[model samples]
Every structure is written in C-alpha cells, then in structure tokens.
Target: MADQLLLKVRTDFVERVTKPVISGLLDDLLDQKVLQLDEVDEVQDRYTVRADKARCLIDTVRLKGTKASQIFIDSLKKRDGTLAEQLGLVAQQGPPGDQLPPPEPSVGIQGQQQWIQQCSLSEYQRIRDKEGDQLPHKKDPLHPRTAESCLSLSSQIYPIHLPRETRTRRALIICNIEFEHLSWRKGAEADVGGMTELLEGLGYVVDIHCNLTSQGMAVVMKDFADRKEHCTSDSTFLVFMSHGVRAGLCGIESGDETTDILSLDTIYETFNNKNCRALLGKPKVVIIQSCRGGKVGSVLMSDSKDPAVPAPIATDSTPAGLEDDAMFEVHLESDFATLHSSTPDTASWRHPKKGSVFIQRLIEQFRNHACNSDLQEIFRKIQYSFGQFPRQLPSQERSTMLRKFYLFPGH
Candidate 1:
C-alpha cells in the first residue's frame, strides 16, 4: 500500500459523498408524507402521524417559498374545523362592517409612548439625585406612578410595521486567515458567499464583506450598531471563520502587540448593545471555526464498537493513523495558536482557500435543515450536524453560548 494515502479530498469530492446520503434522507421523509397538514396548529407544532408530511411541507416551502404555504392552506379547505370556522367567521364579517367605528387616531408612531414613559422614569431618578425629593412634579406626556396616573396597554403589537420593501435579516461571517503570509487556506470569501446564498434562498437580503483588516472589522461592526439603532432587521446572525489562538481570533497585523487580535467581548458588544435594539429579543447566530489547543491523537474512531484487533501499527509517514472521516483535523494542533499570537521574531501567515471546514459544514446544514424552521431551528440543525461530524480541535474549542434568543417559536 502507498505510504501516503489521499484520504482527504477537495470540495467537489466531498459533495459527491454527501449528496447521496442527504438525498436518501429527504426521499425517506417525502415517502412518509411529512408535508401534509390537517389543521392550522399542525402547521407549527406538528402532529405525530403527519410529522413526515409536515417536514415535507417545510422542506418544500424552504425550496419554493410561500407558495407552499398557500398550497398547504388549500389542502385544508375540505375539513370544517377550527381553521375552517375562523375562515367562515371572516367571510361572514365581509369586507366592510356595519357602519364601522372611525379608525382611532394613530398614536404618533408605535411604542413611542412606552419609550417616552421609560425615559421619564430615568429622568426622574436623575432629578432626585441632583436635588431633594421636594422638587414639584411637572405635568408631562408621560405620567408618573402617582395616585392619579397609570400606563395603558397600547393596541399596537409592534412599534413599527416593517415595510415589505425592507429586508429584515442580520447575519455575520468572521474569517481568520491563519497563514495570510503563505496564502494557503483563506476561507472568508467562500464562507461569505455560501452563507449569503443560503440566507437569500430562505428569503433574506444579505450583506457581505471579505478580507477585513482588524481596524476594518471594527468599522464594519460600528455600521452594524447603527443598523440595530434604526431597526434594520428583526433577526440577527453572526458567523466567524478565522485564524485564532487559544485566547481568541487573530488580526491582520500579527506582529504588533496592539493589533494581535480582538477579543470576543469587543465583537459581542456591537450587536448586544441595549440602545441599538434592532436585534433585541431576536435570534443571534454565531459560528466560530478555528483550531483550539489540544494534542492530535494518532487515530480518531468513527463510532466504532469493535475492540482493538490485530491491525498494523502505522508510522507517522503515512496518513492512516486516525480513522476519523472528518477532514478538518490537521496534524499540527498549535499551528493555529502560533498564527494568532506569533512569536516575537516570526511573521504571520494568512492564506486564502475555498472555505473553512466548519463553515462548509454549517452552510450544508443550513441548506438541509433551515427549510421552513426559524433561526433557532437552524441552530438546532447546526448543533446536530456538528455532533454527527465532530471536528478535531483543542480540548478548549470555542463552544456556543447564545443568550436569551427568540425565533418563530416565540422564545
């Protein structure tokens, strides 16, 4: 046998292996009628017998858009159930009601009332701190919690109606060019393009940037802050594929101590801001792909149950030691660490490539799992897929910690 085996293949070859497996899974789902729904609640929560049909419906809409929603609704016309009852009620109501009451004057912009009242409370605190509580309360638009005044629930569910023209999606892709000096595995551009394509397929307008310098990254983040301030999108996502060390991701300026890399806090704060509330209470997705610090084992098992039999003890010259099917695991574990925080005398290496290993898998999962599900569903798919194909990273590989996030599930 050849000493050096070519277990690792290019993107084309990898796709070839994955396509059949995914197609079979999809076909199985379709055969089981995972796309049909008898009731409206079944559309969201799903039914046991009709789960396959529901899943199929989700898959179809993910590929074909809301036309699937209409088709599913049409399928439910025959049955006279709750949804049918509701539709009949609407039909009885007709286009115009009997001398309908005049429309209530628009509360000058939605949510403004609540915002102003909250601001007034803060102001009151400042006034009490600067002066004594003896200051007379002034009559204002916002009422104080005195015996005479109280806050009323606004009829509007949301402050602003997101215009149909405006695209409401927030996504991020952060890449670290580990060996920029060498120009080998630069995955940022591919990461951005693949992710953008996936998002757009799911009805979103995506923004992309490539090869950002450290300072450039900061500037771009500031723009995101401004978007959040203006409520550009209801949901947010952040993807980072970059060269990183044990501490965090590396910067373009590797040698300089000041520009080694930016910490996760700096990046998190930009979107997590309380004032720039565009993504508040919405799902924020973050994907990190880098080498964590750990020793590379000679062999990686592929869920094997058999005990160690008499197999040939391979040497380092050959690529036959670890049996892990995953290709992202490199033999050099600390190389990524050195890239982020280079030795004082050494130079940095940043290379460009088709895409990062983690990123490629993420895109694949998004394409497969994010069909009709919300962002959190997408994350669930991501976590499941990664569990199936574990990466060889340091023991301290970056783990996901999404704070309070709300998606289509309402939480």
Candidate 2:
C-alpha cells in the first residue's frame, strides 16, 4: 500500500523533492537495509539529473514492497517534514504495527527511530486500488490529459483550499495589428490564433480584444483585473501584441514619435496586490509581443523560397514602447512575470505571413514543453532560442512569483 501511495505521487515527488533529501533517503534506506549498497550507488552515480536521482531512489524502494516503502516515507517525515506534509504523508501515515524490516547489519537507534514514528498516527490513511496503468480518464476539458499536477509546483503558492469545482482560470489577449494610421501587422492574426488555442487548451476562458487605444487598453486591463471570476481563479495570463516604442506600447492611432501609449508601469500597478486583491498571491503571467523601437528594424522572411517570390517583407515596429522604469506603486508588486518580445529599445522581427518571431517560437515552445516544464523554464527556452538569431532577443522583464509555475496542460 505504501508503494501504491508512492506510485500515485511519483511525478509530483520527483519534481519537488530536493537533491539533499534524495541523498539522506538513500543513507536511511541503506542503514535499514531497504536498499542494497549497489542500488543506492546506482541512484547516485547512474542518474545525472537531481530529479532523475529522486525517481530512481523512489522506484528502488517501492520494489522492496510495503515494509521498505513505509520506511522510506517515514524517514521522509524526519528528514524533510515540510515535503512530507505536502505529500499528505504526515496525515495519511499507516498503522504503527507495520514496522520497518530488521536491519541487515546492526545500526544505531537513530535509523530505527526515523521510521519508528510511522506507527504513531491517530487517523488511518485510506488505500484505494487504482484500476490500472491505463487510467480511465474521460477527457476533462479543465484538466485535459492526466498530466502532472501543480501541487509539485508548490504547496504554498498554489491554493489547496480552492478545489477544481471552484476554480475558473482566465486569460486575456490584446493584439493591436490594424493600427489606425500605421501599417497593418501582416501576420499578427497567426499569433493571436495560436496563443488563444494554447490558453484555451490550458482551460482558461480567454478574452480576446483587437485594436484598442491606450485608454481603451487601460479600461480592459482594469476590468479584467477586477472581475469576479478571479475571486475563484487559481492564476491568470495577459498577452499584449502591438507596435511599440521606448516609452510604452502604441495604441491603434499611435505611430512612431507619438505619446498614445499604454505604459508598462500602468499594467504593473493594475495587477499589484494593493490594486488587485483577488490575484494578490497568485501568478499573473504577462506577455508583451511588440517592437520596443525601430533601431534593429524589421525582417520579413517568406515561408516559400522561390526565385519569383519577393524579398522578406515585415517587422513588428510601427509605433512603439518598451519596459518602463520602476514606479513606487508597482515596485513591490508580487506574483508577476512579464516577458517582453525584444530587449528594451530594440525592434522584434516578424514573418509577414507567419507571425512575430518571438510569438511563433513561444507558441512552439509552450505546445511542446508546457506539459512538463515550469513556466519560467519554458520562458528561458524561448529566450535561449533567440541566441542563434542575431536580430532580436526576448527579455524576461520582471518576475516576482513565490514559486515555480507549471501550466500542467491538459491537467
């Protein structure tokens, strides 16, 4: 049964269990003879990644059956009490009579005491037999594929009290390609459509708005932040795509040198804890896919390569903005991670028929990796992708999240 419990929480445990705990667990298991010396060596030397080491350690222990598995979990309580509690180990511990196996060699009371307390629980943990490896998952839209749960992200940042029944994850996309006085952002619709599908697949009720002024953008931001849906929501994402400059993002009527902008500082304040209490401690993902300036210029790489095809035709710049300097109101904003398409004051490139290079790459990264990697990790991958392309580089402007954020797509 303990092995069953370990199996159920395998993905979560491997993701969050720290490296030090894995080493300590190995020592304890070796002391109690649950794991042979060679098995421990295999976990330590054969596995390269920390998470890999954890997976190996747990699998090795579980194969020793109920007694060894119970000891491993019990030792977890003494070694890393916080993680034990998070995994429901402390609360769901088994009966005391199911003692650990006798040590193969004589070891001190310390090793015995580590797992001896497992017998000291007031409540019995309920054990249910999972049908099979093939979990009868009837495609739930909110939690799509039976993927890794966010509990592995963090027990603190992710709310335990807010059950799935009460949650309403929401996302917003604002793409301003058809400027009133500027050139049409030729392939921006591709970005919006791709992004919408990604967010919707993650179970968010996405709200899409196109071509708005600075003031209009502010109004929508304010309304979205103040919505009642967020009261029951777990986390939110906001993506803004448009022409931009050093000052801020350009509105529909704004062009180069104009002041009609939705300043980044305004966005920070709108979602800060003081302004938006509902999202105070939750993740507020912000993605800005627009040109920061005209310095780097545009590159329009065509999808087709033919002698008759015209040269590359597009860039994301028209009117512009960039990351704003810190404002006092938003200086201590919590739980916000804002990623910009380009470095401050540089133009981000676009394929006239596809989309901005940043957005298109982001779409690829999230679709392929969101199921396993945390949001920050995925963002870093997107940033790393631009290292090969000299024209533009994406920047993670601000991150104040308290813990890791996994989209846990289809889950």
Top TM-score prediction, candidate number: 2
Residue range 53-135, candidate 1, lDDT tens digits: 33323334333333333332233323223432343211233223321223222111122222111223344334334323333
Best by lDDT: 2
Per-prediction TM-score: 0.41, 0.55
lDDT (Cα, tens digit) per residue for candidate 2, span 1-411: 565466556656876999888999999999998888998897788655675577668766765666888899889989998997787776633464243223332111222222111211221111011111234347678756544332332343244226544568779888776666667777876786667656655656677666678987998899899898888887999999887765577787785465577888888888889889988778899999876654423367321111131223343453433344345324559778888888765667778767888888987787667655667889999999988987778899878876566654433
Name the weakest run of 10 consecutive residues (lDDT summed) in model 1: 1-10
Model 1 Cα RMSD, 1 decimal: 21.8
Q: Count clashing residue pairs in model 1.
A: 35
Model 2 bad stretches (over 4 Å): 1-153, 156-165, 256-258, 296-332
**Error of model 1, residue 307, in angstroms:** 32
